[model samples]
Target: MASGISDAQLAVFVLSLRRSNPPSDTSIVLFMDSVSPRAREIMEAHAVEGVVFDKSKFGDIHPSTYRWPMITEAVEGRGAAVGNVLVADIRDMAFQGDPFEVIGREGGGLHVFTGVEHITLGKDGWNGGWVRDCFGERLLESIKDEVIICSGVSVGDRDNMVGYLKMMSSEMDLPSFKQCERNGVDQGVHNVLVHTGRLKGGGVDVKVHRQGGGTVANMQAGVAKYRRGEGVVNGEGRMVDVVHQYDRDGELQDHLFREFVEWDMAVEGVGEGGCEGYIIKENTEAYKGICDLSHDPGSDYLECCKVCNGKPNCRGFTHIRKGCWLKTCGNNGNKELKVVGATGAWKV
Candidate 1:
């Protein structure tokens, strides 16, 4: 279940999942917000193969918290007919194999994924801050050495997943948790539940699977091994079933975009070559329609600039959130705009 995911990204996730698992053996229900016409088309195309899209709304609550209750309600509606369940982020995830293969038909345990080795929750700045913000420093210190368990993905049997979601939904209902509108605060709550034995008390058999040790790979943490088409693999060298945060690697993200979503880099005007000799400016962006080429979304600033350099008469570029606007300039160079999380570069 996800909100604000682009149509391109939705295609990648749903198509890849359908590709790996036959509809006869698997059922897919996607809970989404504001489904566009194109998104409806994509979902409808797969509806015959057991893909169901349910438009969801949770008012103004942050998606991280609202998704839990919504998911819980959806699963509970299925009653005894529901089987295994895999809760995952849609925008940045893709499947390379049958995700349920490892869990099996009688999925009995709540399986969660952790980051790669050596990146403990306490040691990481962003994750650590999330813990401190939500649970206070004392609670964080108790499990400071624990590896980061990403809340974005998890799999279990219907009962176990529903149980875990119930715990999460009830906790997020508290006044304190409701005030945490920021994204990623759920991670703190999730870790607290697992390490403090709260989940176990709720009848959830939590099983922690480290990166490369399980069916899922947290790409942001790092992967020990990866295959070109297969993505991250385990210590045993088998291809992982699901890959999360794959956008961290620009090349691999592009590969999946092209293969699964049919993202046409050539049509998008992305080309090779570094931004050598190009001036670098911090926190700048080019205004729209300044370039011959349209804006292109990439993984980072360097990739944006590289796309600019690859185009003809490209004089400058503005970048933010993996988007690049290649710009053409007059003899005086392009005018700069001040935007946070945005960068602009130009040549004299």
Candidate 2:
């Protein structure tokens, strides 16, 4: 499950998962601050299940504080219905294959993945500097070189996963966590807990999956390592099942989205039929006046189509030189002002 995901991000994430995994094999649960109309539209369009949680319930604390509670809810709510659970970030993430299969092979009790080690310590990384400032230099020096744990993707058996979340929730109340607030507390506290062997005592059997031969991969080092068509591979040259933190690199993020998500959406005729339960008027003029959605004069017609398709109430769009306008009232807004050089099309 994920939280605070925007409409566009949710669209790609849900669509990509559907393309990669069949409904019989997997179920998706999304946790968000609140579901907006657009979010509801996307969820309905993609058939994704969503759960709402109020971030304000946690009181004056870091936003990441909600992660533990949301994850715990998912784990306990599902109960024994699902044998395993994967709590992951929705943004900048895509599934190339069935994540459950990977988790099954990993032999999970409680599995966590390691991110880039270079930035885990020293003054170079913000997390490192924050750790020193919060916990003091003494604690920082003790585990400065240890590999930082990424809280993005985690997997385990239902009971063990719930146990881990319970432990993490309790840790958030510690006094030291106050100093680490607003920083990367999720990762910092998680790493500290694991490094100190605190989770082991809870029967978590914490298994750390490093860079290679792991189900989930963290692309914190940038996009140089991932080839265009071969997918993201680890040191062992095996394709990673789930990729996280890809947004760190804009170019790579776009590349992956286009390959894994956009292509499938286009092929599957998603939003190709204009508004749902409405007839679209093609090659018509929006003489009533145009409502420009994008000001980019050089925007492509296909892009305009996509923008209109994503909007739930959009009935049609008019494309002109470097401008795109989406109409909500269908073909009855106004017939007075004639728009010159605008070609209108329905989102089929």
Candidate 3:
């Protein structure tokens, strides 16, 4: 689920999912507040099949908290028609492989991914505060040392996920939960339920996967091993199925952005019109620049493209090797030179 995401964010996610080779029968249900026309068009162009866009709103409750309830209702409505269900964050998420590949065989349980090996509820400031505010300091103290169970991504059987989502939804309605303004209180609730054995009491089996050893990787919590073409990989060096919180790492983020951009560009009209108001040219370099802008130290063309796109009066940028030069056309001086091993883009 997503809210207030840009076209590029939406494009990267759906496009990555489509590229990951999900089963032919798999369906994608997007519970989002809004999606621009350009974003929808990008999804269609990528041949993202069996997608249902749900725009349901839960008054006053933040999307992060309300998504559980929404997912609960959706799962219950589907009955036993679907197999496994994955609840994931959108904007910062990308797929390297089929997410359902491992879950399909696991069967009838909630699969939770933990954060960095040693980081716990009390140690991580954001999560610690959320748990304290929404649940209480006592609850936080109870499982303070336990490895944090992240709610950013989760997988389970249809029935089990429904039960889990129902519990999360019911908890969100509590006075303490409603009074809390924090966006990710759901993660606190999630960790509480998993560590406290609440789901087991409710007849749901919970399986916890450790960071760097699981199918899902949280780039923000741990030092994730990232490859240019493979994305994030586990200890075995195989590409992980889902990469969450990827935006936390600048280099990884740029790599994935360029990968998605390259992929989008391959699909004819997708690159031209999907992101909107910008044209991307492969193997092309900007001839002249008004000024040069440095990236995040080690960043490449992707960061350069991003910088130029966001900067006002930055008509274009030329990427060469490890550097990118921002350009401004003076009397139409911004020319596209066909330079190999480079990319140029400009906002019209």
Q: Of the candidates shown, which would achieve the greatest lDDT relative to the real structure? A: 1
lDDT tens readout by residue for model 1, 114-185: 865667779888777877777789988998898888899989888889989999888888888655557777
Q: What is the lDDT of candidate 2?
A: 0.65
| Off by more than 4 A, model 1 | 48-60, 105-107, 263-318, 322-348
In candidate 2, what are the lDDT values of residues 301-339, reduced to their tens digit?
A: 566666776767766666666666677645453442222
List the candidates' TM-scores in order: 0.75, 0.68, 0.72
What candidate 2 gets wrong by more than 4 Å, as runs, is: 57-59, 119-124, 133-136, 222-224, 259-348
For all predictions, the C-alpha RMSD in Å is 8.3, 11.5, 8.3
Leading candidate by TM-score: 1
Question: What TM-score would candidate 3 get against the native?
Answer: 0.72
Order the candidates by TM-score, highest first — what do you get? Answer: 1, 3, 2
Model 2 compared with the native: what TM-score? Answer: 0.68
Candidate 3 clashing pairs?
none
Give the Cα lDDT of each candidate. Answer: 0.73, 0.65, 0.70
Q: Write the per-residue lDDT of candidate 3 for residues 224-245, one digit (tens) a residue.
A: 6887655788766767888888
Tell me how candidate 1 scores on lDDT: 0.73
